[model samples]
Target: MTRPWTVRLAAGLVAATAVLTGCSEKQEANETLPTNGAAETTPELPPLGPEDFPVPAEAREMTPEGAVAFVRYYVGLTKFVAENSLDPEPLLQLSQDCRTCIRIAQSLDEDRAANRRYTEYAYEFTGYGPAMLDGETAQMGFLYVQGPITVVDQAGKVVTDRSAPTPVELQSGAVLLWKPEQATWVITGLTVG
Candidate 1:
């Protein structure tokens, strides 16, 4: 049987994989501005680049909702991975134009020997990044290092850690990532963040 920690680690990696992607979604009006009764304008960031990833930042400078939203999208994408038992689909949900995302997605479908079955997924990120707000478009720094992954069975009770080979924690690559969506800040690119 797989190491118990391996399962936990894989869950963590899966969660990290969901966020640090290269998909580009449509931007909303201005979703980067703070919701502290300030002008709802977008944050200043470079135009959608090829590489993006979640970076470290402070909590006060971020919209708690947007930050939470980013995590939710990532977790949902992980579910996609578990449901389809693939990779690129999870990557695709994170990005619409990442070569890696597309390639990974295709491989998930092509590689039928990947997973034995679909199950539950969960992730808890303990890092921070620059979550910019612009009108309704929010751009989050696309580079992050998510850790301590924990996976559960269909009944929801499993755990793991880094280097467990179960994909538990994720040491994101040297890619800068950002979310380009205007109304919602879905992770849209990968970079060296």
Candidate 2:
């Protein structure tokens, strides 16, 4: 039989990928600003709701609630990676030995190699479901979210815009394991399907 930690790792990776892969949502709003002689227009970020994931202030506190919060925070990070193909240093510190995390990092490399960039990237969580709690680790099962992603070339022209009318429902079956000594939650695995 596989070790319990091994099982947890698998679950974590699966869930993480599900969330990470679906990280392409854009909120388009044009705002007008007064310039020297005329009005200038700029795009505004998407509106945020409670369901949206916010980066946590303290990740090391151990609790079921903390695990859930961490997972929520992770969703935001996933969206950042998908849109920009860039890995945030703060998130990298939390995720150690996480395959999805590595894949995200690699995607940035691929984009650079191909001379492409992504923009108007965003994600939204429809639901933050209850987590399956063990002792130190927790599995956040099947949280649904949706968004769009747009790719651009080095010349600043639009390449591919993977946008859809319906929000892509990601049954984010992500698993997170907490570390008391480190005061953080490590993503052991993510099930993308």
Q: What is the lDDT of residue 69 in candidate 2?
A: 69
- CA shift at 175, candidate 1, in angstroms? 10
Residue 71, model 2: Cα distance from true site in angstroms:
1.3
Model 1: per-residue lDDT, tens digit, 1-193? 8999999999999987777653454546776755678567755543221133222232112364455455444544544564555544435554546555565457445533533343433444433454555553444433233322333334444423211223244433212233334322444443322
Candidate 2: segments with Cα more than 4 A from true spot: 1-55, 81-91, 112-115, 161-166
Worst 10 residues of 2 by lDDT: 44-53
In candidate 1, how many Å is residue 193 off? 9.9
Best by lDDT: 2
Q: What local distance difference test score does each model get?
A: 0.43, 0.62
Best by TM-score: 2
Q: Each prediction's TM-score against the native?
A: 0.36, 0.58
Error of 1 at 88 (Å): 6.0
Predicted candidate 2 versus true structure: per-residue lDDT over 4-40, tens digit per residue: 9999999999999988877755656669755698657
